[model samples]
Each structure stands twice: as structure tokens, then as C-alpha cells.
Target: MVDADQTFVIVGGGLAGAKAAETLRAEGFSGRVILICDERDHPYERPPLSKGYLLGKEQRESVFVHEPAWYAQNDIELHLGQTVVAIDRAAKTVHYGDDGTHVRYDKLLLATGAEPRRLDIPGTDLAGVHHLRRLAHAERLKNVLTHLGRDNGHLVVAGAGWIGLEVAAAAREYGAEVTVVEPSPTPLHGVLGPELGQLFAELHREHGVRFHFGARLTEIVGQDGMVLAARTDDGEEHPCHDVLAAIGAAPRVALAESAGLELADRALGGGIVVDEHLRTSDPDIHAAGDVAAFPHELFGTRMRVEHWANALNGGPAAARSMLGRDVVYDRVPYFFSDQYDLGMEYSGWAPPGSYDQVVIRGDAGKREFIAFWVKEGRVLAGMNVNVWDVTDPIQRLIRTRAQVDTEALADPHVPLADLLP
Candidate 1:
């Protein structure tokens, strides 16, 4: 257990950071707990930013991880709108902005989340061009969407990932003409493979969302400081009133990099390297959330996951490790997404392009199916799309790593629980 007098500092006020602070308090650490956030708002969740909140189905207050009163009640100090400029590892302190405010910590947790990758092309600074990562960004996008609905505007989304697709669905729902441009042959091809990707493509197409597959964004054109059109490398220009560059996000590793922490391999996207216990090279400092690349004993590889579940669970694991508890942080990685009429739940780890075969149960055409990625008859990963109440069984199959006949696995008549040993 940590000493009662040593302060524990948490950087980044997103879900992970907030959970870490909660864990520290729950673990009976009576010392000071300081959570530094760059945003003025209290710590909040991000998934709602692109879904319910953006669609007007949820209110602003629902997005926060905790009500403001909870922090004060828990005796957790919150330093909002503050940027940590540098980490003085030797002095065990973090320097804030130019004003010279600093905080000392006996144990520090870095949950610095990722930021959306900005488009480098021309006209990206136009008024109608946006990237959604923070609540402020979503608020701006929602306002633009509201006006676009009245004007019968067109929106061009430059990417086909989860954010891009979900935004496309929401935009379509808002009565905007929507077009999605993707460099890949199919949307979500890298993670869900082409078959499932095609299902998503079909789903969007049926909803009047146009697509430009195998097309790369060349430039965004603007008129009077507002987006008017988007040009692709395929020589096609899509006229639009708004553009969302949902290409991807890069981990915010500036603090870890500046502190001279060991980074993972460049091939693995270069996040702060951590051991099984989530401790970085410097034992006093630990990394979690999107910025941590830790070894996965199940997959026999080091990976960094940017999904919500990873951050949700990893925070407490890192806190346990900080308090000198025996923890491995080996839980099977899980993530879920909601797009259009489909709800998906995926579990276990199967790096892109590693699975040998994909076996499907139920009808893919009916949009209700569970797809499992197997390698040499051993289940590696599984995803249930539009299917409910099977995540536990799917994860159990992955955890056991049992060999099974593909025919029995694909037969919906056979119970998933019956296959488990």
C-alpha cells in the first residue's frame, strides 16, 4: 500500500485518468490526489461525442465521467485548463505552462489520451471543416449539422473508420447529403476483414450514403473561408458544405517522450512501453489508455489499443500496480461500436491480417451474425454484429484456445455454451 503522505498525480482528465483517481482513493491511499486536465470541463466519456450526444439523443451532462461535486466530495483536486509543459523526472515534478506552476508526485500516472489527426491538405482551416475528438469539437460539429439541415447542405467525410461511419449515419439522419471517401477497398477492412466490411458498405449504401472506395483525399476546397468541395486523388471532386476528417488519431506521447520513457517498436505505433503490471521503464511512472503499449501474454505480442474498454479497465489495473499489488493486466481486450441499425461487440486480440479463417454463425445477409477468427482451428478473436448476449461465450472460446470443427461452430443449432469445455 502507498504511504498516506505521498501525493499521487494523474495527468489527463479523460475517462482513464478519472478512473485512476477513483482507484487510488478506493485503494485507501490517503495522500493527495491531483488530476490535471487541459480541458475546462470535468472528465468525461468520448463515445457519446460521436453517437448519442451528437445525434441529440443524449444531453450534455450525461457525457461527464462524474458530476463536479464528486471530485470535491472525494477530496480529489482538479486542475482544469492546465497544460503540463514538461516532466522533471529527476525532481519528481511536472511543470505547467509558462507561469511556472508545478506539482510534485510520489507516483505519477500518464493517461494522456490521443488527439485526432489533422488533415495537412489545403483549405483544412476552412470554417466548415472539422475533426471530432473533444466535447468542444462535437459541439461545433453539431451546430454546423443543425444549420446544414436547414440549408439542405452536403457533407463529405474523409475516412471510413468507426468515427467516419458513425458520423456519416448521424449526418444522414440530420437530412444532409453524405459521401464517404476511403483509401481502402472497403470500410473497416483492416480490423473486421473485407467480408464484414462489405456488409457495412452495403448497410450504408442502402441508407443513401455514397462511397468512393480506393480513393485518397487530395484537397479540401473552400469558398470565403468555408468548405465548399472535397477533391480526391481519383480526379473526382465532391461538392460539399462541410467536411469531417475522421482519418484516425495519434497517441499524445509528448509527456512520455519528453520524460525519456522507453517507447515501443515503431511498427507497433510507438506508444510508451509498459510491462505486464503497466509500469513503464521508470517504476514510479506508469502509462495507460491509448498511450500505453504493453505486452499481451495471450497474443504473444505487444499492442496498444485505442478502444474505450481498454482505457476503462487499464486505469484500475495500473493503479493496483502502483500500490504494489500483484496484477498482470491480462484481461482480453474488448470493444464495441454502434452504427446505423447495427450494434457490435468484439473481444480478444487478433491483429489485422493474422487470422487464417473466419467462420460465421447465423445469417450475414440478415445482418445478424457472429464471426470468429480462427488460426489452425483455435479461436483467436470473435465479433457479434447485431447479435445480443453472446459476448461472454465468445470471450470464453477465445480464452480457452480450444480447437473445434468449423462445421459445428458455424451451425447455429449448436449452442455456443455447449462448445466450451
Candidate 2:
């Protein structure tokens, strides 16, 4: 057990940071714990911000990770609306907030998370221009969608990534006219590849979502600081009262960067460089969640996963490591998404060029399929769309590293468990 005088400082208020504090307490670490959050709200999960919360289906209280009283009860020093301005690596202290409150620590965790990438083009400052990364943003969007629905106005989403597509679905459900502009030919081109990407396109099209493929938003034409329409590179203009920038997110690594922590290269998904144990170059510091680019033991490469599961699992793993436990945070990356009536869970990494073939088990046309990315006859990743109760078997296939027969893998009659070696 650690001495009570020792202190651990965590510089984030997301799932990862909150879970780390819980883990530290559960592990019997009788030490001071400090959690710094830039946002005023309690530590919260972000998935609902773009999903159920935006749809107005989930309660506002459901977003928070813990009750307001939980922090004080747990003896956690929670600092809300306080941003860590600088990290003094040599001094082992952090300067935060407007008044520059100082906090020293024996160990530090950078779970700074990520921020939504903003549109670099013009007219983004207008009213009705939205981005969904925080609960406050979700609240604003919920109201915007309601107004758009009532006014019979339009919402143009810029990007075909998960955020863009999910927000599109929510907007449509609210009775707002929706249009998506993407630079890629298909939605989620970088993630699901062309085959599965087209499936999403058809799914949205069936639900009245217009797609502007192979084009990107260049300008948001507005008047009196309110969005009017958006223009694409193809010179086609989409008239809309509101705009949502769902392009992507950049890791919040400024604190880590300023502290001279080594960062992963941009091509490898830039973030603070960490080992399998989540320790940074400084050894006394660690990073988790979206801001940690660590070596993936299974894939033999560095990866920075920005999913809810990563934050959920990574925080506890980092907390264990901080407690000097032999922890290897190699839980296969996992994440789930809900759009309209479709629910999908993806496991493992299978980016483009990493897999040679995508084998489908169920009917792709029906959208009840499990698609596997295979290379050298081994499963690289698996995604189940509208399928139930197969996450275990799917992840098992990825972990076994066993060569699989394509025919049997694609055969629904052949049990996924039977294919396991």
C-alpha cells in the first residue's frame, strides 16, 4: 500500500480519469488524489452526447460518470472547470486554473482526451453551427434539432465519420431535413472501407438522408451570424439553417507536448507515446484514453483508440500501473454505435491495407451481418451489425490468432465457437 502522504494527480475529467480515481481508491491506495477537469460538469461519458442524448431519449443525469456526492465521499480532490495550463516536469507540479493553482504529485496521469476538429473554412462562427464533443454541446444541439424540426429547416453535416452519420440520424428522427457532405466516396471510408461504407450510405438514404459524396464543405454561407447554407468544393450548394461539423477529433496533447513528453508520429495517430503499461517517456507520468498512443501488442504497431471502451478500460489499467502493479493494457479495442434502428459493435483494428479480404457471415443486404477482416487467413477484426450475443466469440477469434477457413467463417451454419481453435 502507498503512504497517505503520496499524491496522484490526474489531469482529465472524462471516463478514463474518473475510472482511474475509482481504481486508485479500490486498490487501497491511501494517497491524495486530484482530478482536474476543464468542464464544470461532473466526469461524464461522451457516447450519449451524439447518440441518445442528442435524440432527447436519455436523461441529462445519465451522462455523468458518478454522482455529485461520490467524489467527496471517495476523498477525491475534484477540481471542476479548471484547466491544467502547464506541467513542470522537473518540479513534478502542475499549474492550473485562472489563478494558477499549483498541485504537486508523485505520479501524474494525462487523460486529457480529445477535441472535435473544427472546420477551417469561413462562416463557422455563425449561430446554428454545431459540434458534438461535450455534454453542453449536446444540450445545445438537442434544442437546435427541436427548433429545426419545428421550423422544417435543414441541417447540413460536414463529414461522414461516425459523429456526422450519428448526428444525421438524430436530426432525421427529429423531423429535420438532413444532408451529409463527405470528401470520400462512401461514409466511414477510412474505417469500414468501401464495402461496409456503402452499406451505411444505403441505410441513411433509406431514412431520407441526402449524401454529397466525393466532396467536402468549403464554406458556410450565413447572414447576421446565423447559418443559411453550406457550399461544397464541387460548387454545389446545400441550403440549410444549421450546420454540424463532425469531421474528427484531435488529441488534447498540449500539456504533454509542453512537458517535453515524447509523442507518437502523426501517421501513427498522434498522442502521448506510452508503453504497453501506459507509462510515458518520463516514467513518472502515464497517459490513457484518447490522448495515449501506445504500442498494440496484438497488431505489432502503435495505436491511439478514441472510443468509449478505450477510456473505460484504459483508465483502470493506468491506475493499476500507477500503483506499481504489473499491468498490460492490451484489451482488444472495442466500440459500439447506434444509428436509427441499426446497432453495431466493432472489435479489434482492421484499417485499410491491413486486411486482404472482408468475409461476411450473414446477409449484407439485410444489414444483419458479421464482417471479418482477414489477412493471411487470420482474423484481424470483426464487426457485427444488427447481430446479437456474438461479441465473445468474435473477440475470441481475434485473440486466438488461428487461421480460419473462409468458407466456414462465412457460413452461418458453422458456429463461431466451432471455428475457434
lDDT of each: 0.90, 0.94
The residue-level lDDT of candidate 1 at 55 comes to 91
- Candidate 2 residue pairs that clash: none
TM-score of each: 0.98, 0.99
**Measured by C-alpha RMSD in angstroms, how accurate is candidate 1?**
1.1
Give lDDT tens digits, candidate 1, residues 133-154.
9999999989888877778999
List candidate 1 stretches off by more than 4 Å.
none
Off by over 4 Å in 2: none
Residue 369 lDDT (model 1): 92
lDDT of 2 by residue, 128-220 (tens): 799999998999999999998898989999999999999999999999999999999999989989979999999999999999998989999
* Model 2 error, position 52 (Å): 1.2
